[model samples]
Target: MTPQQYHVIALSSLGGAVAAGISDNDLGAISGYSLLSDNATLHAALWYPGSTSAIDLGTLGGVNSAVEWPNHALGEVVGISQTSQIDPLKEQWSCSYPAGSGFLPYTGQECRGFVSRFNRMRQLGTLGGNNSFATGSNIFGEVVGWAETSKRDPTCVAPQVLGFEAVRWGLEGDAHALPPLGQDPASAATAINDVGSVVGISGLCQNAVGALSAEHIVLWKDGIPHQLPTLGGSAWNTPMMLNDEGAVVGFSDRPGDNNGNNFNGHAFLWTSRNGTTDLGTLAGDAVSYAYSINNRNQIVGQSCTPGCASSRAFLYQHGTMYDLNTLLDSSSAGYSLIFANDISDEGTITGLAVSGAGSILAFRLVPNGGWSGSTMGASREGRSLPFRLRAGSFGRIMPNLTH
Candidate 1:
């Protein structure tokens, strides 16, 4: 398939929207966040295949909502939406803001994981706490993510004494707390396969921000947690997405002292056959992350230099990670494709793209030719690196649209 010109999604009239995740199937749904005309509040949005205007998934009564990960099938999406209740503790629960610019800042409020059905948002209750986040769902309608618990823990950093646990939610909103490795105070299940296997992080409750500085990558099979090895670092051992075949991909620190930051790790793929394989960064770039993995094991994320000031989107397949900028058409100058979030089985990618003048818009790239080597290659890194990081949504922000 030859690469075709990418299409920009139309989410807002003011043009500050970003697409964070896409469904795993070919021509799957697209989800993200966008500001209303006044830009006072944000809303989780879903777009049907080939549609430009987004369907606003209203909040659970609060002013903001975000879709981070949608199911590979239709009529299913998992994300965080705020409720009408105000946060009495004034805590900054980690999953509040998103990556990149052109979005509102974090305003902490009571939020929870939600599943939208027939145009209504249903809250997935926490393990006695007030906040929960749903990151991914399987075809069976089971959801996997993290949720706050009732008890306060001593290991927590300031302002975040409550503990959280990786959980699996059934179709009926029943919460099943996935076991953590040892006595770690927090765990977060980021992705689940169709067979009910889960993948996420197990770590100390450093700041109640879920699994930051995660001690180990954990995979749950039949409700048992198995520890996965890292790249020899102590933090940022994250597992982002899982394919149906049980292969998982994410980012991990490579024996560095980046203080457990996700921005300091290299993208990695894990399978039973090969274990964890490090997907190296673009030429001269220091960091990379794999946020979404399709059924074919094609991975998409971002690679950036130190501090993540300048980054480029990358697609990894067949042992090579290619910078997505080189794959763009010659007519599409003045645009830096940064932070590719998801890739469908058909090789359709969605993420944020910034123009030369610094305007941010959501873009989609469709493969005109199959997964053969396209224009993206290692030789194209010499172009001026103008990419700058805009703080984007936390966890997985996916959108769902229903008529």
Candidate 2:
């Protein structure tokens, strides 16, 4: 009998568009950004199946773009990018930040969500404001994220002026706002299922970035806000993704975090029948985050030490979370799976894995023969210090995509 093993396909990221997300079984197609050769620009990028190089999706007349979420739809990729227009408000919105570098001095340029197809990018317009950000989309060609309005928000801190709300865009780029839970001033639609059920966070306007704005985890069904059961605390209750079966997965802070934004939490799974269950962290770890889940209930995320300072990629299945580094074939000696971002329904996992030398890159774990990742690896792991924090999602403005 042929033995079960993982074929680790390391992805290349040196240079590149539109940002996008959700998991379709597109071989090893990945969505992210790369620092251009000039070292001053960040452009959205895509890695086609079995390709070692990156395909850069140029910006909409601006210098920066990123595909933040993992879109499962192969034909469509949606994300945020900057345009040539300068912001009249002179504000540093969420788009002012990039992944690797710190804040880019509030370029004062307007940013908008974009959809990419066949290597071409089309900008998605904002709702009476200068900025919009796309988080993720389902197979139905529906995009979900945040968009701004014309009115200036009083609750918003300095540097964030226009009021923003959660948004859902159709295939034709028509978008409408999603109401926040109760009287909460702002919200974001992080993920959606094929059936139109959307999951996200609803809270005060805060800084118009993330984190504080995600104080309440909410699921919208048929346009009504149904706040999901929580993992006790309220600060970072973010619903990163949900499967077609209505299973929602993400991170939720416990009661102990002194600073509200500090991500002292555990990965959580919420279902209709079972309610919310805390998926414990890796052995000796202080936190965990479930980024994506498949129809089979397999979950992927990172196990971290306090606010995700140090982390390792993890695959959670059958009531256990295992460090992905332990499952690699012998040739993966120098690689350490630091962030398991998405897992396809077929059990293929993709994420950023840092090397021993500290160069981080993308990787795919494909199950061969008769074995699948759902039933692989025991969770026995000693504390590992090989991985560090993921590059900040928006420079110092925000560290994570949703939160």
For this target, which candidate reaches the highest lDDT against the unseen true structure?
Answer: 2
Query: What TM-score against the true fold does each predicted structure earn?
Result: 0.87, 0.88
Task: Report the C-alpha lDDT of model 2 over 260-346, residue by residue, as the tens digit.
Answer: 555577889999999999999888788788988988898888786654556677888888777877777656666767677788877
| Candidate 2 local Cα displacement, residue 280, angstroms | 1.7
| Best-performing candidate as measured by TM-score | 2
- The CA lDDT at 226 in model 2 is 89
C-alpha root-mean-square deviation, candidate 2 = 4.4
Tens digit of per-residue lDDT, candidate 1, span 1-403: 3333443332232233333434434545677666555444567767667765667878898877776653554577677887888767665565553211212235667778888866688999999887888888877788988888888867777666578899999878999999789877789898897778899999887765533537789999998999998887777788888888888898888775456654457889999999999898988888778888888888898887765656778888788887787776555666777678888877788776666665555666666453334444334542233322233332222221110
Q: Clash number for every model?
A: 22, 17
State the displacement of the C-alpha of residue 257, model 1, in Å, after optimal TM-score superposition.
1.7
Off by over 4 Å in 1: 1-27, 97-104, 210-213, 261-263, 331-333, 356-358, 370-389, 392-403
